[model samples]
Target: MSLLESWDRGEHTAETLRGTTATYATYRKGSGPGVVVIHEIPGLTPDVIAFGEEVVAAGFTVVMPHLFGRPEAGLSPLAVAGAMRQVCVSREFTKLATGETSPVAGWLRSLARELHTELGGPGVGALGMCFTGGFALAMMVDESVAAPVLCQPSVPFVPGRRRGADLNLSPADLGVVRERAAAGCQVLGLQYAGDPLTGTRFDTLAGEIGDAFLRVDLPGRRHSTVTTHRQQEAVDRVLAFFTERLS
Candidate 1:
């Protein structure tokens, strides 16, 4: 189905989550364990919302926060450029900084905590794509985040080899994430092998998280795994991952 068709079928409630640093407008739906769906650079567009609906249909409560861009805006080159500009200049996001977590990740952790506390599950799940992809891994610093999925995590912009190997996580945060992985917290990452935006960070993930990092590398340069590129196998794998980790 088209993204618009799937979006229309989703019955999501609009709500606001107040974080210490930012207040996020969010779309929420479904029941059971909570899964925070962080949008790509172009904001919560139709494709992103459709992906959220898929998560809801999978038996988990899905909360999609509007980190940037207009909610329900359909994909367009102009819209994407506009959102990309905003993300590039936004103080909340550390766009070109290596080994540093975006400031927004803390707010996301708060949202996840609240969701898991209210939803009453063993832990919460998180899925982030594109610019927001590494945010899921950053949230893993907290024990409440059980299932963290990263799709084409492109951040710290990959200007050089050092940044390419960086996970967009601060040294302290990276330590916590490593510890969590060592404790058996699994992380799932998806990307196209030829996508430059993803850089060599998946290799970094493999090295840092060891066997706990599950890599879903598709062939070619497709950037968006669950949305723009629309890989059915990746989607199935994510659903299965969430079911295994959160259910």
Candidate 2:
């Protein structure tokens, strides 16, 4: 069996879930307070879905928003890689399909509200990874986001061959989110040992963000290992973090 299969069968239960597909294919599963999950560079693959389910098993509704609502819905990593290129290279394309005015982020906020209402009013928890790591923070800018877990968040230092360059939140937006954090919201981050992309930047962000930031470093773990390779530990840490912060 694959690694994801093992994690699912042992740690999490699978359930069919749905969310608004207005601009993108959003999906959700499990129960209790909601948890919004954003995908990595490869889009909404089985790995991402499994991660959502893991959170769901921890007693939170998990929502995985399909940012790339096109044909690249977790078929091949290569295809999603191409889509990543398009996101950076073709601004007009992204603007046309998703809009320049923070389309996906807006959609996420709407979904968070949906969870708040659907699950009876406790604001949703958001967990973003790799390409969508900063998405948790972006979701917070709107105020409905109470708890955010960024597992190896990517895209902040998007200059070169970074881990998650697809995340493109503006600095001004960051400032607004930081202001929210100062007002008492909590943002949690988890990363591995040697991921150059998430480690250095994660530290810098934790330092700059101050009390609102909760950083968890897996000493010998790598980038993907945080959630992919080290499945049980990651899920445990995620559940604890969300429970402590969200519950």
What local distance difference test score does each model get? 0.85, 0.63
TM-score of each: 0.91, 0.74
**lDDT score at residue 100, model 2, on the 0-100 scale:** 20
**Candidate 2 C-alpha lDDT tens digits along 38-65:** 7776665666666666777778877766
State the displacement of the C-alpha of residue 167, model 1, in Å, after optimal TM-score superposition: 0.4
Off by over 4 Å in 2: 1-22, 69-77, 89-103, 156-168
Model 1 C-alpha RMSD vs. true structure (Å) is 3.7
- Which candidate number would show the highest TM-score if scored against the true structure? 1
lDDT for residue 133 in candidate 2, whole number 0-100: 73
Report the number of clashing residue pairs per model. Answer: 0, 0
lDDT tens per residue, model 1, 131-196: 889999999987889999999998988778888778999899999999999999999999999999
Candidate 1, 2: how far from true, in Å? Answer: 14
Superposed Cα deviation of residue 46, candidate 1 (Å)? 0.9
